[model samples]
Target: MRMKKTTTAAIGAAALLSGLLTLAGAPAAHAADGCNNDNGRTVRTAFGGKGQGFELRVNGSGNSTCAWGRIVGGAPGMHVWVDRSSDGGRTWEPQLGWAEISSGGSIWTEAWRDSNGRLMRACGDSGYNTAITCTTWY
Candidate 1:
């Protein structure tokens, strides 16, 4: 009976490990710039428009070495982008370029390297004449 229980426990552990490995092998979301959004976390969020239906997210890499923008509830022709600043969000240094949501209601923009005390933020336009919204600097 003891041997039987040990065999069962070993089988269960092997199954669990196999499942974990499968998940770990899953592909990550990659942008044209080759940055992986799967390694990032949303550092800030902002809402806009009626009932706050539109959403903007500022995602930062796990190591704080990269940042990007993502828009949810977006529409075709809508736009999203990431901004970077070297002076603590006082003024924009350069933008990472905009991503037009050509289809669906969600999209991710190109990533920008966040280095040298740079701050990053997410911004978007609904393309419906509504005012643009931006998340706070991270």
Candidate 2:
């Protein structure tokens, strides 16, 4: 009876550990859950190379005054981001918001507030050594 109880305890411990690891590996929810298209719009789009078959988008909401990046029709491992600038595209910080397609055709980055005269644009790469492409600032 003692041996049976020990085995049962071991199995329970293993199951608990497996559940904890799965939760740790899962992606976290976006911080701007409500800042999506339902509350915003696609401000601009950046098309990649004709053969690359990828488009990067800058999405924003006038009411929320926030922006994010989205990549559509890209293979897994491709990358997308939103860039922000105060002076224009000529000089700006890179990858203000970003996301990678882990196993899907599309993905979007976390939203960022576009206040204080900030300008935003979308950019992406084929993730196979292709050059990065970006859209006009908006």
Candidate 3:
């Protein structure tokens, strides 16, 4: 039940891009009708760390039209980021975060794994929409 994801991976201002880091995101299209989505369900997530897991960043509006995206389509503050816990998903990095709060929000993100291996990722404002959302897989 993986949802189609859309995203933008712009790191720093274009003036600082070094062509090293990847700032790519998911596609733009959204589900035709998340109608099947349960009621009162917010925060949509998928995962693969150790135990069964997935976390919802936001609540389900039950519209199926709502997803991890800019509140108004292509906003400039919200974004997505991800980190890993090679040490058995115990400790993560000090940084390696994502969001759009700095710029007032950028866009929400669809979570998923990059390969066939088990993966888990996510994207969303911490809560107040002050930082960019993020997603990562491994």
Candidate 4:
């Protein structure tokens, strides 16, 4: 199966949630709490690829590094975009220009770098809104 580029209707929320999933691993097929909602973007990188990335940590209510993430229960049409590059952040492919939040009243997200300089991001829903936010990448 291929990962299609999808856009959520919620807007800013989508970006936040996408960040959560990327940083926290939302368990698309199974349940994995290993990536639960956490505090402000914490970064940790173990010897994996080239050995230089990190694990993002996020929290709800006030810890946000990106836009549209300072408040909870954002207005309708809230969302975000993502960009990535295998060349070490020099050039990035517009992963998801923008997406919306489907569910969850509150959310938190985190981001970090990997050993190979590959970017890793994650985010999670807190209120459990349930709109099914998605991501799109090239």
Candidate 5:
């Protein structure tokens, strides 16, 4: 009778520990959720070289906007940037610089505010090549 009780208790403890470990290893929930396009707008543009391309996401809310860039394929040494224009693309802010996507595939994001009635642009360059392509988000 004592052996039976000890075996049952061990099983119960193992089950409880398994449940706790699963919960502890779970991923945390996001705080801001996702970009709310209901009160705002979103645009996606494609750029890059032949087999290697990139997509840009422009999420705009009120006078604020966030831009994100992601590599579509295995593009090595690819770099991109986001530029802001307050005067309907007549002029643009300084190039926000370039970022190379990580090997594990992570997206690059930038945010700016007080850009009401302005425009956002995503540009990309393939390594040392001087040629570039840009897309505007209104």
Candidate 6:
């Protein structure tokens, strides 16, 4: 009947408007801040003198990890590295070093396999020896 047709048209119009509104309000997908990768797992800690810190992230693919370091309060001559582990946190591989002189901050990334589940350890140095700050496992 006429009422049934009008009701169907109203429902269709409402559905179309809802879909349009959802699309209009949607935001574009963006990679994680700093690391430029989709980090599904994250670990953060402080290192060196006060205000210095390190963060490690594992990509969603579980085949890569990224490390970021920052020296707050105007610290200079920063150094960083990421150590990968496959046996939980019991053992860490050799230090995968990162460049220094990043007065503001620095980021580093490396590929890895997730067969045994992966782990990443971040280390930072203001000027002296490097030390572990945080560890992330995925």
Whole-model lDDT values for every prediction: 0.69, 0.70, 0.34, 0.33, 0.57, 0.53
Model 5 over residues 42-105: C-alpha lDDT tens digits? 3666655544555556565564555544455535566666666678777776445357655643
Candidate achieving higher lDDT, 2 or 5: 2
The residue-by-residue lDDT of candidate 2 on 1-138, one tens digit each, is 999999999999999999999999764433344544445567677777633333333344364567777777777888887777778657776775567889977887777666567787878887868789887788
Model 5 misplacement above 4 A: 1-42, 102-106
- Which candidate wins on lDDT? 2
Evaluate candidate 6 by giving its C-alpha RMSD to the native, one decimal.
14.0
lDDT of 1: 0.69
What RMSD value applies to candidate 4?
18.1
User: Alpha carbon lDDT of residue 50, candidate 2?
Assistant: 38
TM-scores of the models, in the given order? Answer: 0.63, 0.63, 0.26, 0.28, 0.56, 0.49
Name model 1 segments beyond 4 Å from true: 1-34, 50-64
Model 4 scores what on Cα lDDT? 0.33
lDDT of 4 by residue, 19-127 (tens): 9889786432221234233354433212112221212333332222221112244433344333444675566544222334455432333222222344433222222
42-71, model 6: which lDDT tens digit per residue? 545555565565555455443333433333
The Cα error of candidate 1 at residue 80, in Å, is: 0.5
Cα lDDT of model 1 by residue, 24-134, tens digit: 976343333444466666778887563233232334444447677887776777777777778988888443657787888888866666766877788777775768888
Candidate 2, residue 95: the lDDT equals: 76
Residue 115 in model 2: lDDT:
56
Give the worst 10-residue stretch by lDDT in candidate 4: 45-54
Model 1 steric clash pairs? none
Which candidate, 1 or 2, would have the higher lDDT against the true structure?
2
Q: Write the per-residue lDDT of candidate 3 for residues 1-138, one digit (tens) a residue.
A: 123222232334443564333433432223333322233233444432222122333223322222222222323333344343335445643222344434432343332222222222353443443544433432
Residue 63 in model 4: lDDT: 27
TM-score of 3: 0.26
* Candidate with better TM-score, 3 vs 4: 4
